[model samples]
Target: MGELVARSLIALLFVLNGAATARDPEPRRAKAAWFGNPPLLAVRANGAAMVVLGLLLVTGWQRTWVASGLGVLLVLTTIGGHAFWRAADRAERGRELTQLVKNTAVLGGLLLLAMP
Candidate 1:
């Protein structure tokens, strides 16, 4: 049951964040302004994906595929949202770098979950 608990915890993380982002995407959109036009729409869509996919993962429905999709979303978010390379100062870079590392670890977990 450890695996189930772990999966639920991870999924919960995504679900809560996703719900918040879907409800208010302005901050994410602003952060990723350069990603595309209609940034708000994109942010909301990304958040919605996170919610749906995270639920699928928790429910063990197509676990591998759901995890893979979540991993992809995470990579996109890390690149656009964190972007440590674009930081203008030491403190900013450090903050972004921390986020990048945390996202990387989460992505690793997703990858393990994606394994058959």
Candidate 2:
């Protein structure tokens, strides 16, 4: 039951993320601080990677390896996108901090799913 719920959540996250990227003309620039200054190709690649990772998680294929990879990618993304910027203002910084926490939680959840 819990596994089912987790898979559903992960799938939902992927769908929403994919939709957001598809809808936005300049996704990289739109969330520049959060996503880093990725080249267009890199941004597209990352999006594609996320979709594949999400699918793997949902399908429970090589569960541990896939989840670990996703966790690593999320960690790197959080550090590169949010931590690196260190917004000047309190409000902006707070938002970034919140995003960091959210990303960390997602990573943790993925790790837990990967565990035996």
Candidate 3:
């Protein structure tokens, strides 16, 4: 029951993320602001990797390794993109901080899913 709920939530998260990546223009701006405007190749690669990871999570394939990898990525992304930049305004900093916490929670969820 708990596992089912967790799996459902993770699936919903990934699906929503994929859909937003496909349809949202704001993400591009946010990515550029946070990630030093990485080259187009890098962006595409990240998106491709995200899609593959999302599929793995959704399908429950190699659950431990996939979730671990995703957790690591989320941590690294938060550190590299959000924590590294201390924004000038409280509002900006708060937004980034919230994202950091959110990513951490996602990491926790992935770790839980990886557990037996």
Candidate 4:
């Protein structure tokens, strides 16, 4: 079904992104530095949470609760990682803005999934 496919894709996104961050976290660390020097462990924690939440979402167990948790996670990551306004390079700024918008839209989809 289309819903399953959508959920699968979203879950894949979370898993892949999380894996990348967990493995090579310098990029994420740089982004966090834009606000302040956040600890590397925090980035690892995000990665771990994303993978777990994404897997739960794909399984469709307690769908509403999983979706709500993922939605909140996405929003927090967007605020922490995608502060486009703080980007000095124009191209980097543009990229961050795009990612911010994309994540925000995904947050909406997660909220929709959260509905009973």
Q: Please provide TM-scores, in order, for all candidate models, with all chains considered together.
A: 0.93, 0.80, 0.74, 0.91
lDDT order of candidates, best first? 1, 4, 2, 3
Per-residue lDDT tens digits for candidate 1, residues 4-94, read 8878988997999899999999988877766553467889999999999999999888999999999999999888888788888999999
User: How many clashing pairs per prediction, in order?
Assistant: 0, 0, 0, 0
Residue 54 miss distance in model 2 (angstroms): 0.5
Among residues 3 or more apart in sequence or in different chains, the pairs in candidate 1 whose N, CA or C atoms overlap within 3 Å are none
Scored against the true structure, residue 16 in model 4 reaches a CA lDDT of 89
Regions of model 4 farther than 4 Å from truth:
none
In candidate 2, where is summed lDDT lowest over 10 consecutive residues?
21-30
Give the whole-model CA lDDT for all candidates, comma-separated: 0.89, 0.71, 0.67, 0.86
Positional deviation of residue 30's Cα in model 1 after best superposition, in angstroms: 1.1
How many angstroms is residue 95 displaced in model 1 relative to the true structure, after the best TM-score fit? 1.1
Question: Please, what are the lDDT tens digits per residue for candidate 3 over residues 74-115?
Answer: 665577567625677888888888887888888789888878
- List the RMSD of every prediction in angstroms: 1.2, 2.7, 2.9, 1.3
lDDT of 2 by residue, 5-100 (tens): 887697567656744554452645446545446666565566567778888788888888878877776776567667635688888988889988
Q: Regarding TM-score, does 3 or 4 come out ahead?
A: 4
Native-vs-model 2 lDDT? 0.71
lDDT of 4 by residue, 1-116 (tens): 88777778888889889888888777888777866677898888888788898998898888899889888878877888999998889999999999999998888888888999
Lowest-lDDT window of 10 residues in candidate 4? 29-38
Model 2 CA lDDT for position 3: 93
